[model samples]
Target: MIGNYLEFNVFFDIIGTIAFAISGAILGCKKKMDILGVIVLGLVTALGGGFVRDLVLGINPPNMFQNSTNAIISTVFSVLVFMFFYFRKNFTSRQVLIFMNEFMILSDTIGLASFTITGMTTALSLGLDKKFLLIFVGSITGVGGGMIRDVLAGTIPFIFKEQIYAGACILGSIVFLLTRNFLGDQVSMIICFFTVLIFRLLAVKKNWNLPRISD
Candidate 1:
Protein backbone atom coordinates (compact mmCIF):
# COMPACT_ATOMS: atom_id res chain seq x y z
CA MET A 1 0.00 0.00 0.00
CA ILE A 2 2.76 2.42 0.92
CA GLY A 3 4.69 1.57 -2.23
CA ASN A 4 1.70 2.31 -4.42
CA TYR A 5 1.17 5.64 -2.75
CA LEU A 6 4.80 6.61 -3.18
CA GLU A 7 4.70 5.68 -6.85
CA PHE A 8 1.61 7.78 -7.38
CA ASN A 9 3.23 10.75 -5.70
CA VAL A 10 6.31 10.46 -7.88
CA PHE A 11 4.18 10.18 -10.98
CA PHE A 12 2.27 13.33 -10.19
CA ASP A 13 5.48 15.15 -9.35
CA ILE A 14 6.98 14.35 -12.74
CA ILE A 15 3.82 15.49 -14.52
CA GLY A 16 3.75 18.71 -12.56
CA THR A 17 7.40 19.41 -13.29
CA ILE A 18 6.92 18.94 -17.01
CA ALA A 19 3.84 21.12 -17.00
CA PHE A 20 5.69 23.93 -15.25
CA ALA A 21 8.61 23.66 -17.65
CA ILE A 22 6.30 23.95 -20.62
CA SER A 23 4.63 26.92 -19.01
CA GLY A 24 7.95 28.64 -18.44
CA ALA A 25 9.05 28.01 -21.98
CA ILE A 26 5.81 29.35 -23.38
CA LEU A 27 6.03 32.45 -21.25
CA GLY A 28 9.59 33.07 -22.34
CA CYS A 29 8.62 32.80 -25.95
CA LYS A 30 5.77 35.21 -25.42
CA LYS A 31 8.23 37.63 -23.93
CA LYS A 32 10.42 37.32 -27.04
CA MET A 33 13.34 35.66 -25.28
CA ASP A 34 15.80 33.61 -27.30
CA ILE A 35 15.76 29.82 -27.36
CA LEU A 36 18.55 29.41 -24.83
CA GLY A 37 16.88 31.78 -22.44
CA VAL A 38 13.57 29.98 -22.81
CA ILE A 39 15.14 26.62 -22.03
CA VAL A 40 16.98 28.04 -19.02
CA LEU A 41 13.73 29.49 -17.70
CA GLY A 42 11.93 26.21 -18.22
CA LEU A 43 14.62 24.15 -16.51
CA VAL A 44 14.79 26.46 -13.54
CA THR A 45 11.05 26.59 -13.07
CA ALA A 46 10.68 22.83 -13.38
CA LEU A 47 13.44 21.98 -10.93
CA GLY A 48 13.20 24.87 -8.49
CA GLY A 49 10.57 23.33 -6.24
CA GLY A 50 12.33 20.00 -6.01
CA PHE A 51 15.61 21.75 -5.36
CA VAL A 52 14.09 23.69 -2.50
CA ARG A 53 12.45 20.57 -1.11
CA ASP A 54 15.71 18.65 -1.10
CA LEU A 55 17.63 21.52 0.44
CA VAL A 56 15.15 21.77 3.28
CA LEU A 57 15.21 18.01 3.71
CA GLY A 58 19.00 18.11 3.92
CA ILE A 59 19.30 15.83 0.92
CA ASN A 60 22.67 16.49 -0.65
CA PRO A 61 22.89 17.19 -4.40
CA PRO A 62 19.06 17.34 -4.63
CA ASN A 63 16.87 14.82 -6.45
CA MET A 64 16.63 17.07 -9.48
CA PHE A 65 20.35 16.72 -10.15
CA GLN A 66 20.69 13.13 -8.98
CA ASN A 67 17.78 11.97 -11.09
CA SER A 68 18.93 12.28 -14.68
CA THR A 69 15.53 11.36 -16.07
CA ASN A 70 13.84 14.39 -14.53
CA ALA A 71 16.39 16.76 -16.04
CA ILE A 72 16.14 15.14 -19.49
CA ILE A 73 12.39 15.21 -19.41
CA SER A 74 12.31 18.86 -18.41
CA THR A 75 14.76 19.86 -21.12
CA VAL A 76 12.96 17.97 -23.87
CA PHE A 77 9.57 19.28 -22.83
CA SER A 78 10.87 22.82 -22.76
CA VAL A 79 12.42 22.50 -26.20
CA LEU A 80 9.24 21.13 -27.68
CA VAL A 81 7.19 23.96 -26.21
CA PHE A 82 9.69 26.50 -27.45
CA MET A 83 9.60 25.14 -30.97
CA PHE A 84 5.82 25.10 -31.03
CA PHE A 85 5.60 28.70 -29.95
CA TYR A 86 8.35 29.81 -32.30
CA PHE A 87 6.51 28.33 -35.25
CA ARG A 88 3.30 29.96 -34.14
CA LYS A 89 4.83 33.38 -33.61
CA ASN A 90 3.32 34.67 -36.83
CA PHE A 91 -0.02 34.83 -35.05
CA THR A 92 -1.20 38.15 -33.72
CA SER A 93 0.52 39.25 -30.51
CA ARG A 94 -2.82 39.66 -28.75
CA GLN A 95 -3.87 36.13 -29.63
CA VAL A 96 -0.58 34.70 -28.50
CA LEU A 97 -0.78 36.62 -25.27
CA ILE A 98 -4.28 35.32 -24.59
CA PHE A 99 -3.26 31.76 -25.25
CA MET A 100 -0.19 32.02 -23.06
CA ASN A 101 -2.19 33.57 -20.24
CA GLU A 102 -4.73 30.75 -20.25
CA PHE A 103 -2.02 28.09 -20.41
CA MET A 104 -0.02 29.73 -17.63
CA ILE A 105 -2.98 29.77 -15.25
CA LEU A 106 -3.84 26.11 -15.77
CA SER A 107 -0.28 24.85 -15.71
CA ASP A 108 0.63 26.94 -12.69
CA THR A 109 -2.33 25.59 -10.73
CA ILE A 110 -1.38 21.97 -11.37
CA GLY A 111 2.26 22.60 -10.59
CA LEU A 112 1.33 24.41 -7.40
CA ALA A 113 -0.74 21.52 -6.07
CA SER A 114 1.80 18.86 -6.99
CA PHE A 115 4.75 20.69 -5.51
CA THR A 116 2.80 21.58 -2.38
CA ILE A 117 2.03 17.94 -1.67
CA THR A 118 5.58 16.93 -2.43
CA GLY A 119 6.90 19.59 -0.12
CA MET A 120 4.66 18.45 2.72
CA THR A 121 5.82 14.92 2.18
CA THR A 122 9.43 16.03 2.23
CA ALA A 123 8.88 17.89 5.48
CA LEU A 124 7.32 14.83 7.02
CA SER A 125 10.30 12.75 5.98
CA LEU A 126 12.61 15.38 7.39
CA GLY A 127 11.11 14.99 10.88
CA LEU A 128 9.17 18.22 10.73
CA ASP A 129 6.25 17.44 13.00
CA LYS A 130 4.72 20.87 13.23
CA LYS A 131 1.72 21.73 11.09
CA PHE A 132 2.90 25.29 10.71
CA LEU A 133 6.22 24.22 9.22
CA LEU A 134 4.45 21.83 6.88
CA ILE A 135 2.25 24.65 5.66
CA PHE A 136 5.25 26.94 5.20
CA VAL A 137 7.21 24.31 3.28
CA GLY A 138 4.23 23.57 1.06
CA SER A 139 3.79 27.24 0.24
CA ILE A 140 7.47 27.55 -0.56
CA THR A 141 7.38 24.59 -2.89
CA GLY A 142 4.24 25.81 -4.60
CA VAL A 143 5.56 29.30 -5.25
CA GLY A 144 9.26 28.61 -5.68
CA GLY A 145 8.98 27.65 -9.33
CA GLY A 146 7.05 30.77 -10.20
CA MET A 147 9.56 32.85 -8.32
CA ILE A 148 12.45 31.38 -10.29
CA ARG A 149 10.60 31.78 -13.57
CA ASP A 150 9.77 35.39 -12.85
CA VAL A 151 13.33 36.22 -11.88
CA LEU A 152 14.70 34.60 -15.01
CA ALA A 153 12.13 36.42 -17.13
CA GLY A 154 12.84 39.70 -15.35
CA THR A 155 9.35 40.13 -13.86
CA ILE A 156 8.06 40.51 -10.33
CA PRO A 157 7.23 37.22 -8.66
CA PHE A 158 3.52 36.46 -8.77
CA ILE A 159 3.20 35.17 -5.20
CA PHE A 160 4.31 38.57 -3.86
CA LYS A 161 1.26 40.09 -5.48
CA GLU A 162 -2.17 40.37 -3.86
CA GLN A 163 -3.34 37.03 -5.25
CA ILE A 164 -4.29 34.04 -3.09
CA TYR A 165 -1.56 31.89 -4.63
CA ALA A 166 0.34 30.76 -1.53
CA GLY A 167 -2.91 30.65 0.41
CA ALA A 168 -4.18 27.83 -1.76
CA CYS A 169 -1.05 25.82 -1.09
CA ILE A 170 -1.40 26.40 2.64
CA LEU A 171 -5.01 25.27 2.56
CA GLY A 172 -4.03 22.14 0.65
CA SER A 173 -1.23 21.29 3.04
CA ILE A 174 -3.57 21.75 5.97
CA VAL A 175 -6.07 19.40 4.41
CA PHE A 176 -3.44 16.76 3.76
CA LEU A 177 -2.03 16.94 7.26
CA LEU A 178 -5.44 16.91 8.90
CA THR A 179 -6.87 14.01 6.88
CA ARG A 180 -3.87 11.79 6.15
CA ASN A 181 -4.70 9.34 8.90
CA PHE A 182 -8.40 9.24 8.09
CA LEU A 183 -8.19 9.21 4.30
CA GLY A 184 -4.89 7.36 3.86
CA ASP A 185 -2.21 8.52 1.48
CA GLN A 186 -3.65 8.27 -2.03
CA VAL A 187 -7.01 9.80 -1.27
CA SER A 188 -5.41 12.44 0.88
CA MET A 189 -3.12 13.45 -1.94
CA ILE A 190 -5.97 13.70 -4.41
CA ILE A 191 -8.01 15.75 -1.98
CA CYS A 192 -5.12 18.08 -1.38
CA PHE A 193 -4.43 18.61 -5.07
CA PHE A 194 -8.06 19.28 -5.92
CA THR A 195 -8.50 21.58 -2.95
CA VAL A 196 -5.58 23.75 -3.98
CA LEU A 197 -6.44 23.81 -7.68
CA ILE A 198 -10.09 24.66 -7.17
CA PHE A 199 -9.38 27.35 -4.63
CA ARG A 200 -6.70 28.86 -6.85
CA LEU A 201 -9.05 28.99 -9.82
CA LEU A 202 -11.80 30.58 -7.79
CA ALA A 203 -9.37 33.09 -6.34
CA VAL A 204 -8.28 34.08 -9.81
CA LYS A 205 -11.81 34.21 -11.14
CA LYS A 206 -13.00 36.37 -8.26
CA ASN A 207 -9.87 38.50 -8.05
CA TRP A 208 -9.37 37.51 -4.44
CA ASN A 209 -6.76 39.42 -2.48
CA LEU A 210 -5.20 39.58 0.94
CA PRO A 211 -5.93 42.76 2.84
CA ARG A 212 -3.32 45.51 2.56
CA ILE A 213 -2.87 48.79 4.38
CA SER A 214 -2.45 51.92 2.36
CA ASP A 215 0.26 54.35 3.29
Candidate 2:
Protein backbone atom coordinates (compact mmCIF):
# COMPACT_ATOMS: atom_id res chain seq x y z
CA MET A 1 0.00 0.00 0.00
CA ILE A 2 2.78 2.38 0.81
CA GLY A 3 4.55 1.61 -2.42
CA ASN A 4 1.38 2.16 -4.41
CA TYR A 5 0.78 5.47 -2.72
CA LEU A 6 4.31 6.64 -3.44
CA GLU A 7 3.95 5.63 -7.07
CA PHE A 8 0.71 7.52 -7.42
CA ASN A 9 2.17 10.57 -5.75
CA VAL A 10 5.17 10.63 -8.04
CA PHE A 11 3.04 10.07 -11.12
CA PHE A 12 0.79 12.99 -10.32
CA ASP A 13 3.74 15.18 -9.44
CA ILE A 14 5.33 14.64 -12.82
CA ILE A 15 2.07 15.34 -14.62
CA GLY A 16 1.66 18.54 -12.68
CA THR A 17 5.20 19.58 -13.42
CA ILE A 18 4.80 19.07 -17.13
CA ALA A 19 1.50 20.89 -17.29
CA PHE A 20 2.74 23.85 -15.30
CA ALA A 21 5.93 24.04 -17.34
CA ILE A 22 3.98 24.29 -20.56
CA SER A 23 1.69 26.94 -19.14
CA GLY A 24 4.63 28.96 -17.93
CA ALA A 25 6.44 28.54 -21.23
CA ILE A 26 3.37 29.76 -23.10
CA LEU A 27 3.23 32.83 -20.93
CA GLY A 28 6.90 33.50 -21.52
CA CYS A 29 6.55 33.20 -25.26
CA LYS A 30 3.54 35.47 -25.25
CA LYS A 31 5.45 38.00 -23.21
CA LYS A 32 8.24 38.05 -25.83
CA MET A 33 10.79 36.73 -23.35
CA ASP A 34 13.98 35.11 -24.60
CA ILE A 35 14.80 31.42 -24.19
CA LEU A 36 16.50 31.96 -20.84
CA GLY A 37 13.50 33.85 -19.51
CA VAL A 38 11.19 31.16 -20.79
CA ILE A 39 13.25 28.46 -19.10
CA VAL A 40 13.28 30.38 -15.85
CA LEU A 41 9.55 30.95 -15.95
CA GLY A 42 8.90 27.32 -16.78
CA LEU A 43 11.10 25.98 -14.02
CA VAL A 44 9.61 28.33 -11.47
CA THR A 45 6.04 27.48 -12.42
CA ALA A 46 6.83 23.79 -12.41
CA LEU A 47 8.74 23.67 -9.13
CA GLY A 48 8.03 26.78 -7.08
CA GLY A 49 5.00 25.34 -5.31
CA GLY A 50 6.77 22.15 -4.28
CA PHE A 51 9.74 24.17 -3.10
CA VAL A 52 7.49 26.36 -1.00
CA ARG A 53 5.62 23.36 0.38
CA ASP A 54 8.87 21.73 1.43
CA LEU A 55 9.99 24.92 3.15
CA VAL A 56 6.70 25.12 4.98
CA LEU A 57 7.15 21.54 6.13
CA GLY A 58 10.81 22.09 7.02
CA ILE A 59 12.14 19.73 4.37
CA ASN A 60 15.57 21.10 3.64
CA PRO A 61 16.95 20.86 0.08
CA PRO A 62 13.45 20.15 -1.24
CA ASN A 63 12.68 17.31 -3.60
CA MET A 64 13.71 19.18 -6.72
CA PHE A 65 17.31 19.52 -5.62
CA GLN A 66 17.37 15.95 -4.42
CA ASN A 67 16.12 14.78 -7.82
CA SER A 68 16.88 16.67 -11.01
CA THR A 69 14.36 14.85 -13.24
CA ASN A 70 11.65 17.47 -12.93
CA ALA A 71 14.01 20.33 -13.62
CA ILE A 72 15.34 18.66 -16.75
CA ILE A 73 11.84 17.81 -17.91
CA SER A 74 10.64 21.37 -17.44
CA THR A 75 13.68 22.84 -19.15
CA VAL A 76 13.34 20.60 -22.18
CA PHE A 77 9.67 21.39 -22.55
CA SER A 78 10.28 25.11 -22.16
CA VAL A 79 12.86 25.02 -24.91
CA LEU A 80 10.44 23.18 -27.17
CA VAL A 81 7.78 25.81 -26.61
CA PHE A 82 10.25 28.57 -27.32
CA MET A 83 11.45 26.93 -30.46
CA PHE A 84 7.91 26.37 -31.67
CA PHE A 85 7.08 30.02 -31.19
CA TYR A 86 10.35 31.29 -32.56
CA PHE A 87 10.10 29.28 -35.74
CA ARG A 88 6.47 29.95 -36.44
CA LYS A 89 5.82 32.00 -39.56
CA ASN A 90 2.83 33.76 -37.99
CA PHE A 91 3.75 33.86 -34.33
CA THR A 92 1.31 36.68 -33.54
CA SER A 93 -1.65 35.49 -35.51
CA ARG A 94 -4.99 35.77 -33.78
CA GLN A 95 -5.83 32.10 -34.31
CA VAL A 96 -2.54 30.98 -32.85
CA LEU A 97 -3.00 33.21 -29.82
CA ILE A 98 -6.49 31.82 -29.30
CA PHE A 99 -5.22 28.26 -29.49
CA MET A 100 -2.40 28.98 -27.08
CA ASN A 101 -4.82 30.57 -24.65
CA GLU A 102 -7.06 27.54 -24.75
CA PHE A 103 -4.12 25.19 -24.34
CA MET A 104 -2.87 27.23 -21.41
CA ILE A 105 -6.19 26.88 -19.62
CA LEU A 106 -6.21 23.11 -20.16
CA SER A 107 -2.64 22.74 -18.94
CA ASP A 108 -3.19 25.00 -15.97
CA THR A 109 -6.28 23.09 -14.88
CA ILE A 110 -4.48 19.75 -15.13
CA GLY A 111 -1.52 21.10 -13.20
CA LEU A 112 -3.78 22.48 -10.50
CA ALA A 113 -5.49 19.13 -9.97
CA SER A 114 -2.36 17.01 -10.14
CA PHE A 115 -0.35 19.15 -7.73
CA THR A 116 -3.23 19.29 -5.26
CA ILE A 117 -3.01 15.53 -4.93
CA THR A 118 0.78 15.53 -4.64
CA GLY A 119 0.69 18.10 -1.87
CA MET A 120 -1.91 16.29 0.20
CA THR A 121 -0.27 12.93 -0.32
CA THR A 122 3.14 14.29 0.64
CA ALA A 123 1.69 15.73 3.82
CA LEU A 124 0.00 12.45 4.69
CA SER A 125 3.10 10.42 3.92
CA LEU A 126 5.05 12.57 6.35
CA GLY A 127 2.69 11.48 9.17
CA LEU A 128 1.01 14.84 9.36
CA ASP A 129 -2.59 14.09 10.25
CA LYS A 130 -3.91 17.57 10.72
CA LYS A 131 -6.76 18.13 8.28
CA PHE A 132 -6.33 21.88 8.08
CA LEU A 133 -2.63 21.58 7.44
CA LEU A 134 -3.19 19.03 4.72
CA ILE A 135 -5.69 21.24 2.99
CA PHE A 136 -3.52 24.31 3.32
CA VAL A 137 -0.48 22.58 1.96
CA GLY A 138 -2.48 21.06 -0.86
CA SER A 139 -3.93 24.39 -1.84
CA ILE A 140 -0.54 26.05 -1.76
CA THR A 141 1.04 23.32 -3.82
CA GLY A 142 -1.74 23.55 -6.32
CA VAL A 143 -1.65 27.30 -6.88
CA GLY A 144 1.56 28.76 -5.55
CA GLY A 145 3.62 28.28 -8.70
CA GLY A 146 1.03 29.82 -10.98
CA MET A 147 0.63 32.76 -8.65
CA ILE A 148 4.34 33.39 -8.79
CA ARG A 149 4.34 33.02 -12.54
CA ASP A 150 1.61 35.63 -12.95
CA VAL A 151 3.35 38.08 -10.66
CA LEU A 152 6.58 37.64 -12.57
CA ALA A 153 4.69 38.10 -15.81
CA GLY A 154 3.24 41.40 -14.56
CA THR A 155 -0.38 40.27 -14.26
CA ILE A 156 -2.64 39.78 -11.26
CA PRO A 157 -2.75 36.16 -10.22
CA PHE A 158 -5.86 34.53 -11.61
CA ILE A 159 -6.71 33.02 -8.25
CA PHE A 160 -7.15 36.50 -6.79
CA LYS A 161 -9.60 37.91 -9.32
CA GLU A 162 -10.48 35.53 -12.12
CA GLN A 163 -12.47 32.30 -12.31
CA ILE A 164 -12.51 30.04 -9.26
CA TYR A 165 -8.87 28.98 -9.26
CA ALA A 166 -7.57 28.60 -5.70
CA GLY A 167 -11.10 28.00 -4.53
CA ALA A 168 -11.22 24.92 -6.72
CA CYS A 169 -7.97 23.66 -5.21
CA ILE A 170 -9.21 24.24 -1.68
CA LEU A 171 -12.41 22.41 -2.42
CA GLY A 172 -10.50 19.54 -4.00
CA SER A 173 -8.31 19.27 -0.92
CA ILE A 174 -11.43 19.07 1.17
CA VAL A 175 -12.76 16.31 -1.02
CA PHE A 176 -9.57 14.28 -0.63
CA LEU A 177 -9.63 14.67 3.11
CA LEU A 178 -13.27 13.68 3.30
CA THR A 179 -12.93 10.56 1.17
CA ARG A 180 -9.43 9.28 1.74
CA ASN A 181 -10.18 7.12 4.76
CA PHE A 182 -13.37 5.58 3.45
CA LEU A 183 -12.32 5.17 -0.16
CA GLY A 184 -8.56 4.86 0.21
CA ASP A 185 -5.84 7.15 -1.07
CA GLN A 186 -5.99 6.31 -4.77
CA VAL A 187 -9.73 6.62 -5.15
CA SER A 188 -9.80 9.78 -3.11
CA MET A 189 -7.08 11.29 -5.26
CA ILE A 190 -9.02 10.53 -8.41
CA ILE A 191 -12.14 12.14 -7.02
CA CYS A 192 -10.21 15.16 -5.79
CA PHE A 193 -8.42 15.67 -9.10
CA PHE A 194 -11.58 15.51 -11.16
CA THR A 195 -13.38 17.77 -8.73
CA VAL A 196 -10.85 20.54 -9.25
CA LEU A 197 -10.57 19.98 -12.97
CA ILE A 198 -14.28 20.04 -13.66
CA PHE A 199 -14.93 22.89 -11.30
CA ARG A 200 -12.23 25.01 -12.89
CA LEU A 201 -13.41 24.25 -16.40
CA LEU A 202 -16.98 25.10 -15.52
CA ALA A 203 -15.93 28.32 -13.91
CA VAL A 204 -14.09 29.27 -17.07
CA LYS A 205 -17.03 28.41 -19.28
CA LYS A 206 -19.51 30.27 -17.10
CA ASN A 207 -17.27 33.16 -16.29
CA TRP A 208 -17.66 32.51 -12.61
CA ASN A 209 -15.90 34.76 -10.15
CA LEU A 210 -16.24 35.64 -6.51
CA PRO A 211 -18.24 38.72 -5.66
CA ARG A 212 -16.01 41.75 -5.59
CA ILE A 213 -16.49 44.82 -3.43
CA SER A 214 -17.09 47.05 -6.42
CA ASP A 215 -18.66 44.48 -8.71
Best by TM-score: 2
> Residue 62, candidate 2: how far off, in angstroms?
1.3
Determine which window of 10 residues in candidate 1 has minimal summed lDDT.
1-10
lDDT tens per residue, model 1, 1-215: 44536776787788788888887888888778888888888888888988887787788988877888877887898899888877884645787778888888888888899889888776776667788878888888888888999987888887877479889999999999889889897889899999999999999889998987769
For model 2, the stretches where C-alpha displacement exceeds 4 angstroms are none
Q: How accurate is candidate 2 locally (lDDT)?
A: 0.92
At residue 23, candidate 2 shows an lDDT of 96
Candidate 1 regions with alpha-carbon error over 4 angstroms: 1-4, 126-128, 213-215
Using all chains and alpha carbons, the TM-scores for the candidates as numbered come to: 0.93, 0.97
Candidate 1: clashing residue pairs, number: 0
Note the Cα lDDT for every prediction shown.
0.84, 0.92
